[model samples]
Target: MTVLEADRLSADSNRRRDPISSRGAARADTVLAVEGLTVGTGRADLVIDVSLDVRAGETLCLVGESGCGKSLTCLAAMGLTSEPLIRKSGRISFLGQDLSLLRENQLAEIRGRDMAMIFQDATAALNPVRRVGMQIAEVLVVHRGLTWSQAMKQAVELLASVGIPDPAGRANAYPHQLSGGMNQRVMIAMALACRPKLLIADEATTALDVTTQVQILKLMKELQAETGAAMIFVTHDLGVVAEIADRVAVMYSGRVVETATVDDLFERPLHPYTRGLMACRLHATTTSHGRIAAIEGTVPSPSKRPEGCSFRPRCPYASDECMALPALRPIAGIYGADQHRAACHFAEDFARAGS
Candidate 1:
């Protein structure tokens, strides 16, 4: 059965060689749309003016260092934010349902069934006392209306599909008894149990080793291909972006500074922050510099953002125009450029000078 699924995914890949958005500028089907999302405590806005669309069967990677509000954005989309930190103003629409208006009970019904989140730390995500398989089966039982025995059978299959050696035996094991990789795989199995329409992986691979990260990422891609679910992958790794993203959003100080197709981003990044991020990559430094480049300074606290560009303090290309926030608008043309947008006053000037 797994082999058949693999065959189907291969055929699917052959039919659509690029990410869904690569075939066109406008996404005909949007699974999740976030508009002007702002979240904050009464003191200050932590996530401001954020917007993005996740088309069906696409992977959008949110790349930024910690504290850029990527994870918060995900939580907001899920309507999971707790006290004090309230959603200031925004709209989170998933599969035609306005999530912002949903009550906790409604959101609870939506979560795991329609949208699922894979947290960064799988250990904490999984129940400590419950058998991993039982935990996974619970989702199936609740959302898919399956009996315990039936759900258990499916859970074992899920574990096996995720590469567990002895799916049945592993299924009986507690999360603490498994390796970090195993635990992570279990979290993924739980998230995929319902075959959700939208999957949000928040730094899901951050805790894994290099080999495990690669394996987990490959597994996710295959699972996504099979499920055809829209995904929002949050991470600080550009390498992960290069490997899995169809579209990339570079966030800084709680806002997306740039957005572009994965190919365009790697070929020519428009935002200074994006460029700085790429330069920080080890692969980009084959033999040029003795040291890998580093983006100077740190992501500022939400309350401490500068008057203009939040990244202006660390950006090398800053000018006086950067003293004012630049709206995230589409980068003006050279054809096929309507989809690429950057929130930098000097985006055009920099693009032209670099060209």
Candidate 2:
């Protein structure tokens, strides 16, 4: 069967299984809601009008190339955006509380306790001078009111829970002493130390080897399931998205280009950008030419983005109509019932043609 046919079948099956898939129900289940988020420096916006929501116990993967603003969005959600770059406009609500209105101290209180993030580089995020156990213990000490001795004891158990070997001994090792995978496991232990309601993993497995990456992904999924926490997993790898994402938001040039369930995205990608990304993945047929398909032209820098669709210059299907920016709108007909959205003038046509 063709991709569109598969998407139709999947949608039909989902509808049959859950007849009351309403926006109201979705909103009620949301653990984090971000709307009209715009992060920028004085001269240019790095992340523009991005809105995202993750339901309780859901994994939302934000996928894009290096400069596509995926990481910035995650940082903004965590209120960790620092100087030079600022959140110009947005409302970030966590568990129905508006985080934008909270002070840094207030946000700090919620951070490790209610929401936590695992940065892209675990070694950099963890302190070199501090023992791994002390780092994890710090969270429990600050947020859970545990004594240093008690916290350190539990820290070893946390490390063991994340599959670290000889956790008691390993906890005493400094960040630099551990290998990449072990440090990442330590970071996971720290993030989950507080049993956060929301977990944002920004390329948590990007630096690990294939075997270690798989283990980390499996560990994360198991932990998330156990705690019933919502997750925002950021990555450029579609393979990772397929493994972990319930839904995906595809971003390009600082704006969200498409959003859909994982199956719908892989089966019937509507936006040209999303399709380009999918095509870029290596497959058996890709060996024919000894050259992989690639989206032409690098993502335009935020400062140099075109007046219309930021992707217009690179989009093969660009036209005069595309000179006007397209809002991220739902596709018409059956796809609309699934809430599949794409920001492209020809999304409907692309969907119809199954391109």
* Candidate with best TM-score: 2
Q: Which candidate number would show the highest lDDT if scored against the true structure?
A: 2
lDDT of 1: 0.85
Model 2, 212-265: lDDT tens digits are 887898788888878889999999998888877778999999999999888788
Off by over 4 Å in 1: 1-28
lDDT values for all models: 0.85, 0.88
In candidate 1 the C-alpha lDDT for residue 202 amounts to 97
Instruction: Provide TM-scores for the models.
Output: 0.92, 0.93
Show the colliding residue pairs in model 2: none
lDDT of 1 by residue, 172-211 (tens): 9998999999999999999999999899999999999987
Give the runs in model 2 whose Cα sits over 4 Å from its true position: 1-26, 336-338
